[model samples]
Target chain A: MKPTFRASMAWLHTWSGLVIGWLLLAITLAGTLSVFRPEISSWMRPELHGRLTDADTATQAAIGWLTAHAAHAPAWYLEAPSPRTPFTYAVWEDGTSYAQHALDPKTGAPDVLRDTLGGEFFFRFHFELQLPYPWGRLIAAVAALALVLILLTGIVAHKRIFLDFFTFRPGKGQRSWLDAHNLLGVVALPFHLMIAFTGAITLANMIMPWGLTTLYKQDFSALTHDFSPATIEREASGKPGSLTAFGPLLADVRHHFAPNGLARITVTNPSDSNAVITFNAIPSVSGVGVENHTLSYDGITGKLLAEHRETRPVMGFYRFLYGLHVAYFAPYVTRWLYFLSGLSLAALICTGLQLWTSKRCHRQQGLGFKLVERLNIGMMMGTPTAFAGYFIANRVLPPFLANRAQMEVRAVFCIWAAILLFAMVRRPNAAWRETLAISSLTCLIISLIGGIPHSPIEWAVSLVSLGIAVLMRYAMRYTPYRKKQS
Target chain B: MLLPLSFIGLLAVCLLAAATPRQASELFTPPLPHKQQILIRAFGFLLLAASFFVGSLSHNAGRLLIAHIGLLGLYAAIISLGCTLCLHNKKRRDPAKRRNNHT
Candidate 1:
């Protein structure tokens, strides 16, 4: 007999989710961590802590350093220090390659700190999967699409979604797992849908480039110019020229925008007579949009050249989708909500994976079933343990060690692999408990020796790590291994 | 202001949960009457709308809307867990009451 509509949906939901569930969890968890990327980066670079400088001073100092070190570069990019991040980040092309430095806000010198990717690693890994360009993003985009499909199918299959909104019965094994899964999925349904859909939209250009190919015809520069018409492109005149003082120009821009609205500054042909400086505004918080308002000035004369604001509806909508995905404009309360909702989505996926295994636990299991069972335990607990290992490695490794950043990332994968192998060798119940204990212990160790937090963001991160350790400890004790063993 | 708005959202979600017949039975000794349940559900929805209206008065209505939805979900989860614990406790006590009567 053919399956009913709901049954077919249930089948699709189960298979689609199971196929990419582990990858999706990793992506979601990393994305959640990325929500606090700036904070994490600041915490990792202890040398930059407690030293605050105004944006104007930092920008000038960074420019001075770049002028001395990279004068031959055609252009330079500068990110002013903000409350969240205390370092002035500068990037410039040096001959054939790009060089980046985190400058001390007070002195404009390259920060004397351990080299590490810090939170940027998680941000990149969330969408890029630590793979080379295009492939990781493509894979993540496909996984996001699959997640949307799974969510829709799960909604269709669960007929009592609304009726059982407030229902949960724990300690009943499989039934309990199903209830928890449904509860997590249904409670944050809108957020899950919004995040998945916006995530795909953010990478839509790469995922669906047929339109670009047909319209732009391989001229990427034309596409960029069309997308951002405010961008000024002028070749260097070759005649040596000096830049005008940045103080007056910055003050002028601040008068037009908010005091902190100027987020990035781009200097093109900084040593040429045709030099131009552009200031990009912060993402808009007043509405559901990203207004890429820009002001351009003649670098030599410091005279305003052009001012542009995003007004086209289609482009505005696109920017809004991108803005929503990144949440660049979120305030403190909203940011916390985004973080919690993200974790709830991860929890939803984890519970769904557990439900899949629990439903089949009593059956005559095949190799596939056994493999999935072990994998479910390994990936769910092992991934977080690996993340904690990354933090631990950051503190334990020698400060000036060569390839220190790579070593920290390697520690994550090494720990994850070890946990996966250990899970494969142990009983499922024991594997779960041992992995939880290890994860908890790693977090506890971080809290003990991660150094006293020098700022509010660092303090929050430290406290959160301690909180996770406590929760993991509770989970380790609460796991029903003892009853099953008896 | 956001704190009070979130509290209102939490109260609204609790009312809506209590209006559900199954949850009402678990939460109350005798389930609320059908007419009262309807009133409570309507009031719950009205409160949600009122909270949204008040929250949108801020300069950034979009941000408030997103945060409001997230907070509502959190409140619902908390209420669901609380109800589950309450029901478990009641179930545990009912058997003791029956045993005492038999004795």
Candidate 2:
């Protein structure tokens, strides 16, 4: 006999959500934090330079510093901040190797800046979890697809959906928990769907570029050309060549975009006379987190050749979608609201997982119930342990260590993996309480140690993060466990 | 599961009342009395419709006025249908007949 449509959808929703719930929870929560990553970084580095610096002076100083450091470098990648961020950061590659540093605002000196890891680490962790490039990202992308399916099935299977919205009847056992879950889910449904869809689309080319592959055919170079028009170089010859100078190029960009600042610069086909120089124009719109443009110049003559602005109909729409999803362009109020909603969504997933385990435990299911109980603990508590490890790595690890980012990320995964493995061996409740307590204490103590150098404001942020960590541990201690019937 | 599911169900009902204002489902679900069902549905519908009208009217006076009118009409239709359901339930079980059934 065929099951009813609702029954079929219910099964789909339950299984789909459960299978990828932890992954989705991690990705979404990390992504929410990443939306405010830049601000957090700024807050973390209070001992750095002041809030503002002159752009022209900083650029010239950085170029001069790079010339002195690596005079015969093949290429220099200069990344100057927009108005929002007033620091000069750059990297350069010579024939042998590449190096990166933040410029001192006053002295314009390199290597003076502290080696404190900033928001970029969080940004990288959000998508890749610091895993090996495309593979980790691929796993996350698959999880996103599963999330989309779960949300769709959830909506379809929800009965009396309207009656459920304002119906948080506490202390009604499963009914109360379900009501809270549904309320949170529906309240943030638009955000959840939008973020998942847009996040998938952000790496659209990586996931499915069939359309591009078909259109561009074997001339795949044209795709890069079309997207990054600024990357075009002069036709090559059998003759050797070398780039002239970047001074005039910088001057030209300054004249063209007077009020708006220059965000970044790219040198294509460097060490060739016919190399291309691209000066990315600063966006005029304030608070829209993205900053990229294409203004190509002749590398030999340093003449402004052409400008390809993508902030138009189709591309603009894509940017808008990304902006909405990331909340990069949002004000303080909207960003906090987004953060709160993301926390609520995490709570919803946690409670739902608990509800499933509780029901199964009551039936005296042996190994299966134990496995679920352990997984719930490992996922919920283990994630915080991993996050604390990341902070610890940043503080203790040598700043000049090669591949520091990767190492910090490895520390997180190792801790998380160990906890998961331990959960499998140990009793669920004992491991849960211990891991939660350890993670909370680690975070709190680290915050105090790492935040002492900064001002009261930074201390407060650290305190808040630490407080949340402790609260989570407390919640774990109170969670009910299975009883043995006499 | 039961707790979260029912909350979601109630929320959906309230939102539907707000969004459509005129569409009411005919099925007698949730094991509630006919009169109580009609009253709750009508109240939800009218309240949502009114809030929508007032909010839009105050925010974007010119265009929202038209929106409010349309919403008001929708509320009227839904409330009427809900009232019909109440009457049908009453007809199904007369008070005198109820006494006989009990006896």
Candidate 3:
């Protein structure tokens, strides 16, 4: 119990990281997968499983569809398809309830994706921990900040972190674990630093809102209105106005973008005479920076009225950081890099948890140690298997059932709960082997289950699952259960 | 195409790092003099990093910087695993030689 700096930091790193490490694993895995949110959404909806469409035409088609079907909505947001995303994604409010669906650009028909959340579940889960709104975001902020603290303390505690970055001595139990932990932690140091900071800063608005709160008297609406792009504003005319052709408007906006073109087109009060069409531009390049430019047009006349440009550097900085976190700028190859780094993060967290017992206490029957071991197996193995169950549920669930999406979400938790119970009751070693084997099987067979389309996305995902299976299989050999038998 | 090329360059760089006297000695390879090894390693790293810009600026540059760094880290991990496997194989076949070399 010496009160030395490194010792204090070591103690701090262990406890803080342990308590929040589960949360970190959950978020990191989901956040990594969230890199391909659009692709995942596309894959989940088999109805839209076809060749890609032209962006301009897709925008027009989406507009046409929304004009007819989404007229009841106060406004409609339509994102034109891209290389990675297959369709025109649309979102709008339906009498206080919100609705979002992906539409085929050619047909303007929404695909039959079971009301499942798909990748959005992961994306939202990343920042909000899937909790309700502000509270989820608050918890995410605390978790991210804790990660930042653990990383900083870890850097301080390890003297040879940089020198040992290349060292890895396997087959030496505790030594191997330490080396693996240090190597992964140090090699991905910059990434861990940037991701943790950016994640927290992205929620800085929620965590530290005093500045904005003071300026706008807690009216976030007013604060956003000032910086927001100008849009056409009008009271309801009570008379309906037919929308003009969206093709020319989309073409007009194409000139503004290089390589890539219009991203989203929104229609406000589509049925009213004062209806307006807002064309939002996306960056052509596959990297990060805010490209949320807005060009508002009179819906009836199809004439451009207002243009909103980026003028604030503060907002630009935040968007850059946000873009880094979400990785919307990454192409497919780069996306894999993000996913791999994210897995490294999860590995680091997992190793840290293992070291808590492996390096410290013995294999005692103490309740705390047993509980931690059970929780570790339950989370590390159970979470991924739960996702496998989710994907399977998305395929098997009756598409027409009411609250189908809710059922899909429930499937994840149900599978997770069942596995947790199993992990608690069974020996930890046996639990690990059984859960991983089930995960491997689920991932190995999802696409083979008839009706699910086998796209390149599915293939990429399958390769990852295969990698997980191999790792888990190798891990099964390391369990002390077999060692005891021998 | 660019991704694979980058990966190859990275693998070659890792192999070169393992070829260096300090690293080679640890991996059961003959230890050469340290002369110019540092320079060679730096040059190798530079060549690998330069590959990022060779094909398309948009492919690996700009917003993809984090992804670029992540890939490098992953390559490092793979290299570490490879080195560990090499050491393990050497130890299994001739434990006396490994002990003598270390001593």
Candidate 4:
């Protein structure tokens, strides 16, 4: 009458995974795409393709533009072009007003590129789900916690995890699905655990804010300030002043922070006498923690003020966890590994969902069974189709259309919604095959529309899209039209 | 460095898989003997350690470890697929074997 430990774990694993599986898949896939955020951003802006400029020249040009356009702004931010990104990202804020522009690295002019979120859409959607602040992050955090639980329960329930580490029996229906699930889960167990745990930790402040509430007591800014204390906080003198030359300051930063180029530049009160300029070092591959090594200079005099490096142990640990999750410091090969591991996690969830439905295939179908079957088909195929739609929208939309970026994102959701509705209306097997066929076609169209790649990143993206098309076509052929009743 | 590590990791995982009786049967006519299985597994573990050692020579040990784990998963999956293909081909080539398996 009582369930054994393994049975309880199995029950928990099945229900928990089924409940949050779709959300986890979306988050994982988005995060995976975010691994190449800069590259994707570059690909989306074909106008900037193959453009290269020295960081100092880009910085000076961006500053010159800002000086002309946003002289009255209190602060200006500049992200210099890097090997992966070919454009300077510049932003200016003046209390109530804010603006951003992608500057041509060579000319410092506003690049006449279609306004799109580019890879940032995927990066933000990973945790935010494109929802309003806090809520989406909260939901993502809860899903991550659920994933950790599901993975742990799965490990407990899978008594043959080690034995089946290298076992996969394809085309055996439920058994094959279960085998694939177990194989993927067991092999990538460490990565799954790390990603889930780190994901939760990344948003732990929101989910578990008791400490913040007790200490800061609604003064969130104070908490943030304490975490990263400003090296120089100077009030604007309001007296007009010209900024000192950036070349020598940049040279000094390079000389001091050798082997690490400047990643970001912040100018506070740029046109005021008390202005401060700070340059942040690009993260190096030598450390697991993101070292916020910065050099500050008096903006008016261009004299070096202070140098700061992250030295606090607690902050170092937190940065380490965050760094692992973001993989900002990852090398080329390591980034590919992260991407593959992310795919494996997504595949593991897919296999688990399919196994749930296939296990009860022979039983009398109930409403719950039907819903799960339809949803599984919709989400597994529909999400990727939606992603492809987003890419297609980027190329197809009018370059200067109003709200073009929002329209592209809307296209993703609309396509996904339509496919979900279609899945519900069509037979389960037919839904799977049709969605797969549609996904394949969309991918093929993307590859063709993308045309010849101008950069290595573009080439990789094009080839990958084409590869997915081929794979989807192959899968479409194999997906059975009718279920074989035992 | 990473390429060599990947090669060694793949070989290591294949050996471990071959030591498993079920997978071994798919790859070999007769499953490997118990003693040989143990030896193969030991060698596999040794190579796996070597891969980790080589990987740790990189600037960051933590990142290297993460990469190593990812590579392990990839290698295991490759071996699993390889074994599955081997079994499928054997069953197709030997009709009697396929008939016996069906029965």
Candidate 5:
């Protein structure tokens, strides 16, 4: 077979990656952090620092917290804490609304929790970019497809793939960068491919639920009933009843399901004749957000009523995929491995772009190179600048401000956009150095501010940032370029 | 034969690496043609060292340490070999260039 198709693919890969390298970098980095998000969030909140609670205590607290928070609600949802976390979060639907709150780790009492808007915001942005409903997801999905093509072409373009596997010569400017890119890309091929494909699949229902939509056309009720369970009608009962004895139902759930990493519990149609307490098992796999079972309990008598367990072959397959992708239930070794590899993938994308632009320094000091330079400016430094801004907003913004979380994101984008504009006007070499220094300094200062009430860890991180800034300044000043010999 | 295949391939990559003079034409410009051997070896070493920390944390220190260190050493050796090839190739190519241009 003529390698022309491969050559075209190579071209496609190069251009495709160059086109969306920044976006992919952001996604990969954020996704890597997302694996340890809960842990990071816990550390950020100094209030939750020393207190460690058992599962039973946390669970009880969750139950009480949900009941109090959603007293007048028709249904309640409790997200139980795992071994890693000390507190459980509870949410419930009231009249045309849903409210959520954290439960105390020690007593299962309703506790005001430290805001984790930063962690959650970053996590969501990784996947959805926090754009309007489906738009962010759609853009991300397209980027992921582009990424797959890039990887395939990249592999093919490097004819001596295995030969170049261990090649890395320092002081050889662009050559070293290429080696880094190839090494990372090849070594973590499985991870890179899986992350992109699975990330796309995460939004599959939104993108191509055509089969589900078509097969279950307009018979939405019947369709849901076919796979899941038919919703039984429940009439409200005026008599007040004690929800004290939910223990037996909980026991029943554990016994039947083998304690399936249950994250949340929901009691629907409360105060009704057919009040059903559905204990949803935490999602294990690709359905990271979706739960597996719906174990119903007679809300009044506390008796196990019905169960809709998704243990079938088809459901199991999805669960496995989701489980693998999330890496939550996986052993610690696997999760950390995934995190390191994901970081490498992010580094690969950035190094690849840097290598591309650096190689063409003299060839095209023209419009095209200028455009790439601006993009590199925006991508390479803009992201970290935006991230620093996000941290800044978290510390400076008034807690009572309306939609403060969203504002943090806006701050990030605003800073990122500003840097991109600066890159357009500034010289490429100057821009690279200035932006890195600025980003590092910004991160350092913002982290200091955020760390004031927190701990030394944030300050330590700031020192590292400042150190990076200084190092970048040195490199930018010292690194020399050879004049072209035509 | 395998060693020679590996050696030749590594040398080709190293020559390709050595050719990136920062002023090279875009058409023949090496992709990500920056420091080829040293950086790869450094990163490979760091990754292996990092795995040691991770392995120790997870109590899989013995097995993982051996595996990671072995892999790191192998890559480091290859990178060292690549460096030698790069130097040798540069010597050969530079002399040929001087002769052709009569410089």
Candidate 6:
């Protein structure tokens, strides 16, 4: 590319990266943490650790609980305990919405664990940006699209990327920042591309609803049917028939689907004679763990009704993308890699933002320059502090408080807001130092108070906090964001 | 164990590739010879490619391979950042000490 063309591309890359870098950091960090959703859930509910049982046993327990409580309900849902997540949950229709509870595997009683969103909050925020439905997702999709453009522009802009790959100049202010940005962007080029594209693909339907209409010939019901699990329906015979012991039926299904296990069970008209139960098989960890591959049976007679396994040619591709987005199929080792990649994303953005700020440090003292710097400090440092705060709130919050689960979520956002407000008032460099220090202290407190070295994850998180503190200290010592008057 | 082994091996390969020097210099550090750098990088790439094939035979199949590929890149970036940061801190202080002696 010509120098002029490359410089234009550079302008695009820099501007694009800076415009919404804060939001991207938040989204990416939340996303990366969500990879360990089940593990976090396990940590949050300490009571569920190591108490998981076989799918058949948990299914039976869930069935027994639902039978007693919601016999008259139209439908019942059971999530059998899996190897990954250790809770069996049952849900029944309550008025218009659903009432749900996680059941202890051993006794099948309602789980005494404190109510929390656990890993799911991060998952939702990844695409939703924590805003109400549609708008948050729409903005996320737009951001994903912009990220793809920025990546392309960045590649076009960096003419000597090969040389830059081999270079890292430490103490040279702007040069160091540029080299760091190029290094991070180039190293994870493939991951950055794949994550951006697959992320956009995830909201394919919402992005272009007309495309689904075209595929399904405007039959929304048909589209839903094609995507939904297989089911069998039976009319009520006006005779009440008790639910058969779910354990044997579940065992038989497990044996039939051995190696691949059960994920969910849905019982329709549980007290009626014509009741039907559907068993959905769980895909392997490295496979797309969607609620497909269903085996239906008569609730009254325990007779096998029908079965449908996922076998479509297109499904493999869809599952691949789904699996990539969810990281559902990864082993723990690979999962940590995803988490590290996420932290790198945060680092990448941090370096880019710092580079932008450093470039102007010697010349400009505009409101815009200060505004962007404040945002970077607010989000990059503030978000981590908020995450640590979330864990601490989970630990300290009383279980009996009204809507305590909501309160825990509120604590996370409240801290996030508080940090941003604090960032606005303080000097940007000091804000970076202070917020990172706070994050480090918060993480240390959580680790020690929760009994550090007790669990590998807890220890790992604590170390990350300490690492951030040390990193920020080095950053403060070497960079352009010193307290000199402009 | 196979997955982690392959993962660590891949990261080691990335670090080895990144160790090749960037600029030509006389004093402290010199770029590795071209022949050795190319040979080492080729070997690293081959091993990284081999992991996918071996992973399919392992229980997890192809899923672990793709994740490892992304992770290897991340590890490379972190290592690069760490090396540069260490240099920045050391060089920054060393120059200050030398200048102080002269002054």
* Model number with the top DockQ: 1
Tens digits of per-residue lDDT, candidate 3, A132-245, equal 889999999988899999999999888775346578887666787789889889878878988899999988878898888788996755765576655565666889888887
Worst 10 residues of 1 chain A by lDDT: A477-486
Q: What is the DockQ of each candidate?
A: 0.76, 0.04, 0.45, 0.67, 0.06, 0.44
lDDT of 1 by residue, A29-108 (tens): 99999988888887787776555678788788888877777777989998767667667777889878776667777777
lDDT of 5 by residue, A333-408 (tens): 5556666677678778988887777778857478887798779777778876777677667667764466554576
Fnat, model by model in order, equals: 0.74, 0.00, 0.53, 0.67, 0.04, 0.53
Weakest ten-residue segment in model 6 chain A by summed lDDT: A477-486
Q: What is the TM-score of chain B alone in each candidate?
A: 0.90, 0.41, 0.63, 0.82, 0.46, 0.60
Kindly indicate the candidate among 3 and 6 with the higher TM-score.
3
- Number of the top candidate by lDDT? 1
TM-score sort, best first: 1, 4, 3, 6, 2, 5
User: lDDT (0-100) at residue A45 of candidate 5?
Assistant: 48
lDDT of each: 0.85, 0.63, 0.75, 0.85, 0.64, 0.74
Identify the CAPRI category of the predicted complex in candidate 3.
Answer: acceptable
Q: What is the interface RMSD of candidate 5, in Å?
A: 10.1
- Model 4 pairs in collision: none
Tell me the spans in candidate 4 whose CA falls farther than 4 Å from its real position. Answer: A94-98, A235-237, B57-60, B96-103
Each candidate's clash count: 0, 24, 0, 0, 23, 2
B-chain TM-score of model 4: 0.82
Could you tell me which 10 consecutive residues in candidate 2 chain B have the lowest summed lDDT? B21-30
- Provide the global lDDT of candidate 3 against the true structure: 0.75
User: What is the DockQ score of candidate 4, to 2 decimals?
Assistant: 0.67
**Would you list the clashing residue pairs of candidate 3?**
none
lDDT at A476, model 5: 63
Write one digit per residue (lDDT tens) for candidate 2, span A1-486.
228988898888776777788887777667766766755555534445463467676676665665466544556676775444456666677566666666665555655555544666667666886688797788788877777777788788887765544335444556756766776667666666766777777766667768888899878578778766656655544344555565666777877766656878766555556666678766544424354566888766777788776756676777766665666455454555567666766776877777677656657578777777788788877776776677677667775667665687788789889888887888766786787777787777667756464554466558767777768667664554543422
Q: After superposition, which runs of candidate 2 have C-alpha atoms over 4 Å from their true positions?
A: A43-52, A70-78, A91-110, A114-117, A169-173, A234-261, A269-272, A282-292, A366-368, A398-403, A451-460, A483-486, B1-103
**Order by DockQ, highest first:** 1, 4, 3, 6, 5, 2
Ranking by lDDT: 1, 4, 3, 6, 5, 2
